[model samples]
Target: MNPHNPNRHNLGTVISFEFRRTVLKPKFWLISLSVPLLIGVVVGLIALSGQTTAQRVESQDTASVTFTYTDASGLIDPTVARTAGGTPVSDAAAARAAVVAGTSQCHIDYPKDPLSQPIDVQGKDLGLFDSSRYNAVATTVFTTSIEHKIGNPTLAKLAVNPPDVQLATFADGHATAGIAGVIAPGIFLVLFYMAVLMLGNQMLNVTLEEKENRVTEMILTTMNPTTLIVGKVLALVGIGIVQGLVVGIPASIVFGLLSGSMGLPEASAGVPTLGSIPIDAGAVAIGFCLFLFSFLMFTGLLVAIGAVMPSAKEAGNTFGVVVMSMFIPLYAGSLLVSDPHGVVSQIFTFFPLTAPVSTLLRNATGGLYWWEAAIALAILAVCGWVFLMVGVRLFRTGSISYGSRVKIGRALGWTTGR
Candidate 1:
């Protein structure tokens, strides 16, 4: 390899060298090995937690409902005990006692023809309390109770179910499904942001290692810096995706099986009839693409950072700030649930550094319009291109650049050929 001869950029050769860079590194292999095992342990722990939650919800259902009512209150029937849905109470004291003791689901105590008194409701002639209705049971007892006693018979029927809000939401979906959908955005955001950190640092560390060892001169003879940096970023991005798939696929499979086997209490609660984990193939695809794109965007930036810094030490100092920037998306990601379509969120969705994650979050939250998603993807693609170009420029110049501590301003100037 002649140092003076200019190396022609060949995509194939550069990629070959990049693969070698990853595979030959002992520390890279060690990290790769640990990722799967750590992921498996985390998945197992989550499954265990889910099992406990299911058991807790199921156990709570056995506790009977207790009611409080007065038999002589006239609203309650003292002569005949009514089922939980009817006006059945012997006395106010007994009703209150049953309520306190948790022996009854509900109680209806009546006055001795209490409705005859100065109506407690004041000016209301409607029977908010009726004593005669208890003799013959209605087919729908609670419905009749509300319509005849508590609500206007002519107007819209109103049944203010007080217990419903307090009761454990046994899941036939309810509002819980909507709430769960909202969580998808934040989960995708944090996951993509985390993957970026891993891939970004991996790219930075590799570039710095080569620089520190003066291997750039050796590679420069065989490959141009532009081709070299591009190939390496591409290769590392692939590895990051492979890593994501390895972790995500197994976890998804395990979660599905566990969620099915360990039937959650509210799992069958509401409308959509959820029997298993809600993960669909679409979720897997979105997660996969998000993982890949996020890693690419962050890793490209790291490669550019690596090119400008002459030594590993200089790069490490800047890495603290870089790392913070990558992870800041996670903190901001939570807002996707509350304000998925808010002004601030929309702006971040369009911005380059934040778009990959913010856009992914919007998709997960069902906030994304088709055009917005397309635009964000386009922006990310352009940014990747720009980063690759900048990385090469910085690399070609900074390969021979020597200094005490490199500065960002100096790197920017160098990237622009200053």
Candidate 2:
């Protein structure tokens, strides 16, 4: 490997050119900045209206209502009803009629056999969710009356409303954040998918652009097809990183500020924290490898699709199918989590397109064994290299033909020249 190899120099030149050409475009900046700007605007509005909105909600929830109840079980204490914003009324029929006529907000009828029969609640409909307040008021009054009868307020209160629970699980004799600790490795998986989604179309266009512009011949004359294709794929990845940074940095800052303003606790008992999350060095290393090779395999696939099809429109149909294949594991996410070693999960873990996501998912869930990760990584690395080679062959054949689709047989040297 000579330091000044001509092909290496050409590859660098190609990468530099493609990256700058895409990055410097006004449309690139517009698309990249639009999401963060929209998020910022929304956050600003929420921050400004937070106090007013809280006050409005509190006022609505505590608003007085003309409520009446008929207690056939003799459990309705008049004092409790009045305190809970309800009135005890005789003649259930008259109370129901008042509610229907909008003179009263609600009417509750406690059955004679209270233990066996349901309480009948009739109310003026106040829209779907809000109408539930009627039942809430009636229940509160009945519960308070029961507490009074028990004559032990503290014990009754404890029985009625239990204290908040915080659960902690032990792993290998050490306390861990449970699900969050297990799924932490999946962050790499998420970043890989994000990069692919952002750059998949770019990968499709990179190989096809030269053909579309009818300059493939001139470009091919200066650089080998392998160098050019690899260079363009690398550039597409570079572009994805740039987009991720532009979006992730501002979003992170806004999230930090919003979390502080919202009074989120840094180490809540149930919530997972950075220090609490368990980290396995081997798993993290394998996860990063999975991310890298998976992305390369997908990029190669899209580039090959672009090289084979004559135009972007024609290529996009194939591109969509390929992208959808990657999500096959996600559709079976429940099975993956519940039974990662099952036949279906095993199929996805080994299959080329779905392997990256599947392996990563199982890795995060602590279901994928180290050996399985190795096998999946090996498959992805091989497929990625094969796809790149296939793309190079296709580019050589398809780029020479303008406005016509290149048959796979001819592209791969199975048939006569195109």
Candidate 3:
């Protein structure tokens, strides 16, 4: 039997058994369901809290204002101040007439000295159409005045921004919708963070599991350790994908149903929002690709460590080395979000193992070089080969021996027939 053929080495049996345990196990389902459940509960709680606050503000801010504009032309700016906020009133005469008819709240009188008040609506508890009956429109009119004063063009199309008086986040009212706007991006940041840790840690567990059970030896007889290891890593990656979707779905759905953004208060609510907590398809693809490749490379290293370590405890020390390699890339990816083209980001982008995470992050938030993507992929592929070679050496070295830890010096000396 050819020694290089894993089938002859007993590796194939282990691969099949690894597939069965991972695919049929309840643990797979647990991992898949975990992220989603966690995200749903957190988002639901936040939404609930925001709604409760909205109700309190609506009730307390009941002061109203009525503008009496005797003349339309003289009524220059019939802005009203009231329960919600302030707005410019173009049809002041009609509104004023409504006030006389008890259909409106207050009136704005532009006395001959226009500069004295200078087209600004003053006084309090004001509404153009009467908040008691038409509080909604009345509130709109009050806030429009402030939008005009602020020189916002969005008010022209939207004709309303969060009421100007909502000058402070909670201002006179609860801003559940406003705050929702802020939470959108926050959700993505958090999910991305969770995915990395979840996938990375799981990869570690799996490598240790195979070694601890002594299954690696059984599988090496039929398939090359490289193929066996790579396939197992791919399968685990598929599992991670399932987990990510489960968590992101509900947060996206609930956020979609509500109005506005995730921001505590959108700089201007009602302005078109990106809406739909979307993961960039390109970013997701690139990120996952990077994650998977990085995962494979690390998995190879893990497998080798697991194979040689006498027990799982010894494996922990080996992981420290893996952690060190990950640190630079993790930090680079994070900072790349801020300045993808910055010197540090550009430097890390060239490194194969670290490049995957950093380059993808740059692709997601910051624009990275077009050529860098291809380069990063090719570089990682090569790195994967080198890691595969090391892993096989470790496996071949320790597969037949079962004793204390396998030292690196003896492990590398395998090629020299030491």
| Model 3 agreement with the true structure over 95-134: per-residue lDDT tens digits | 6566667665555444455336333232333344233333
Clashing pairs in 2: none
The runs of at least 3 residues in candidate 2 whose Cα sits more than 4 Å from the true structure, single-residue gaps closed, are: 1-3, 36-61, 113-117, 125-130, 181-190, 249-288, 416-418
User: How do all models score by TM-score?
Assistant: 0.61, 0.85, 0.58
Best by lDDT: 2
Using TM-score as the measure, which candidate wins?
2
Give the per-residue Cα lDDT of candidate 1 at 6: 39
Q: Model 2 over residues 1-418: C-alpha lDDT tens digits?
A: 7667889999999899989998999998887788678878887777768877676556555766667888888887889888767777788999999888988888889888877998899988878756766766767777888899888999879988998666666656755445544534766776677777767778898788888998988988888999999998888778876876687667546655564444333333544344434455566678778887898889888888888899999999998899799788899999998999999999999999999999998988878998998899899989998998899998987787777898889778788852
- How does model 2 fare in lDDT? 0.80
The stretch of ten residues in a row with the least summed lDDT in candidate 1 is: 118-127
Model 1 global lDDT (CA atoms, 0 to 1): 0.57
After TM-score superposition, the amount by which residue 418's alpha carbon in candidate 1 deviates from its true location, in angstroms, is 11
Instruction: Give the deviation of candidate 3 from the true structure as CA RMSD.
Output: 12.2
Model 3 residue runs over 4 Å out of place are 1-16, 63-196, 199-224, 248-281, 320-335, 414-418
* Candidate 1: tens digits of C-alpha lDDT, residues 39-111: 5677677778888766654543332222344433334322222453334434656655554575654444334
Candidates arranged by TM-score, highest first: 2, 1, 3
Stretches of candidate 1 off by over 4 Å are 1-10, 20-43, 46-191, 261-275, 279-287, 403-418
Locate the minimum summed-lDDT window of 10 residues in model 2: 263-272
- Candidate 1 colliding pairs, count: 25
